[model samples]
Target: MVTTAAQIGWAESAALIFRPRVGELLTNTVLLVAITVPLCAVIGVGGAWLVERTSLAGAGAWGAVLAMPLAIPAFVNSYAWVSAVPSLAGLGSGVLLATLSYFPLVYLPVRAALARLDPALEQAAASLGRGPVRVFFGTVLPQLRLALLGGALLVGLHLLSEYGAFALIRFDTFTTAIMDQYRSTFNGSAGSMLSGVLMLLCFALLLLESRARGRARYARIGSGTAAPPRRIRLRGWQLPAQVGLLALGIAALGVPAVVIGGWLAYGGGTVWMAPDLVPTLLQTLGLALGGGLVTVIAAFPLSWLAVRHPGPFSRLLERTNYITSSMPGIVLALALVTVSLFFVPALYQTTALLLLAYALLFLPRALVPLQAGIAQAPQSLEEAAQALGRRPLRAFFGVTLRLVAPATAAALAMVFLAVAGELTATLLLSPIGVQTLATRFWSLSSEIDFAGAAPYATLLILLSAPMTYLLFRQSTVLSRADASAGPAPATSAPTTAETA
Candidate 1:
């Protein structure tokens, strides 16, 4: 995209960059990220700490509630909010919707980290007379560095790449501007310039996160088992914690449910009778499943190379995937459109191209868990199988692959939910006549037909709910396993998630 944008005459590029419109978008995009990422980190870290470290009532159920926002796409959340409050718009609404929808990106990982942390450190700190708050700040928070940073990075990327959510609210960021530019003129220099700028922003975020992560190692080198972490009693604060969680749940999940239900009630059986609805649901399922499996397969080589042969080259290759993954779906779709039209016209507008786009845009989601899974699998087990007269391929499939099944399932669930809710790329690259739930919901919602859009939104959440549960289950199970195994070696290489 940067190359394509740079092809424009220098005078035009400079003029485009300096235009007032560009300045407005740059301001909006920067401010949005600056505000949203920190807010999400706070909410996510706070929520996870409450659920995982407190004696709050129904902690397990609240953990699921915290992740439920992810089952509803940000765009659908926007539709729900707009339906509830027609006047809601601009940066405040953008931050609210993005925070509600993406905080789980932080919560899930940090919750998992909290589960996996060695409680011995906290005990040691307590033995030194440290108070709870001070112990958390000094011991717990630093140990959570990798997970918190990973989640925050994901939130920032989502902020930069998101389009439909901000678009519906009339918030003009670079993504929205790029979409507008593309709609006005296909393959226009203006849109490419915006995309180039967006890519630069994404890279800057990557670099910032990288530096923040630093070279400090958090791994334990001891052979002792981790004791269960002691839960902090809320005591008089219990009521307030519950009230706060209730408020959050209402904002994140209740609003969407009420709005969609109201529309469904208003539309009656007629909404379900929409002739395209069932087919669209099936199409969405097929595409999501296919894209998720393909992304996992594509991620395998990169994960394997990074884990088995750590080097500068491997690290570079892994980071390159993140660079592409961070691009706005529209930017990626446009690039694919250009490449297909010029070099592979036969593949243009086909399911193959659409699936390819999905793999490119969401590779990082699959990479994180897969790398962690691969790193945990015992290479010695695979070698033992090879020595038992099995071929290398057979050994891997029988041993290492089996060991990483949970992680692979976690990766698949994450990507599947992402693809199922994806908007911009599906909008641009779906095969002719393909109408997945996202595209269908987007079309109806874009037309301001809230009642007509309700069923699709309902189906989107229902379809994603199971995968969300599976993702949470897998993460919890893996975290427990890691805890039981004690911390990773201090010399061990970091996974993609840690680097994020």
Candidate 2:
């Protein structure tokens, strides 16, 4: 970053400062986040409440359905929308697309938090003559503040770094601008300047989130059998509530499913068996599997240390890793390009370099789950194994690993789905002539060949579905575990892979 900053000439820097296009990009970026994040929070929190706390029919199923959007990459959602409505290709579309795609980030965490919340305070508030709305605002909402803020932070950071979705929608943000700079001119100084600005935006977001999160502890003390919160009967609103949720699910998940399904059906003759399709799918799978495994292995020690040996240093290491992962993929790809070309030319344009980018960018996806898993494993169990004449490694394998296996698998799946769907880094760092599903889809779609892109897009969604299901299931398990054990501390935000 320092080197890139130093490379920027005063005139070029001044041009960026005064450029109308740059201003538009900044405004679009800000407006997208400002509009989208809050809307996502509202939808997510509201949906979660209805599912988890209301006596709505099929709440469990609705919960899972709400999370399915996470499986559909934002760019694919844009493709689905734009294919249906040609004019949906600007800031408004971008906001709508992103909100639909990312609201699940807020929903999952808040749902988990809601599951673990003690109902005593809420019950007491109701007893004092407070209505449902007042009780929620006065009691439930304050407790939810941390989860909501963390989720919103994730949404904001993602909006700042988003490229593919916004790019497809023709809404320029820092990420897309930097991508254009690299593509059109390989203008390192200008791209780096934009990236530097993005970094500042990310930092400001982190700072704001931290301040908003504060230091308050949300865990319940002196827990007995904490009763489940009383479910408020939807009564007259039940049918409308179900309809609302169904509509949300349709907009978020059904559209992508139907669009991809239509494409496969209509384009089956020519596009389904396109010679490159299998190769691209295989390549994408290979990279995603390799990247997922490597990232989880890399995350294990960091996760282990943070959970088993909590301290300033361990916390710092974990935080540092997250901050690195939060960087825009374009910025990370450019940094890797420069380093590889300068210090290790042999590595440039290699699969190794591309995998490294994935590992760096998606590490947190693995780390979050692994750390939670490790934290849940009892130290006494490891000690018992050790006392039974097992080595530390053996004890961990026998006890800790078994305990965390589900979480580990979930983490692996999350990272795999993320890598399979990733675009900007794959564009920059994948070996020359290599084609993954994402790059191929992007290539075809960029030329307005929705038919050609459809097969790859369908395959991407198909690939993501199981993994996304696993992630949602794992989240539910984690929530249940937290509820059983006692109140959990404010949930840490899960770092997303595509965020810059």
Lowest lDDT sum, 10 consecutive residues, model 1, at 491-500
Query: Considering every candidate listed, which one attains the maximal lDDT?
Result: 1
- Give the Cα lDDT of each candidate: 0.89, 0.85
Scored against the true structure, residue 16 in model 2 reaches a CA lDDT of 65
Q: What is the Cα-based TM-score of model 2?
A: 0.92
What are the runs in model 1 whose C-alpha is more than 4 Å off?
307-312, 368-413, 492-500
| Per-candidate TM-score against the hidden true structure | 0.91, 0.92
Displacement of the residue 477 alpha carbon in candidate 2, Å: 3.2
**Deviation in Å, model 2, residue 33 alpha carbon:** 0.4
Q: lDDT at 258 for candidate 2?
A: 84
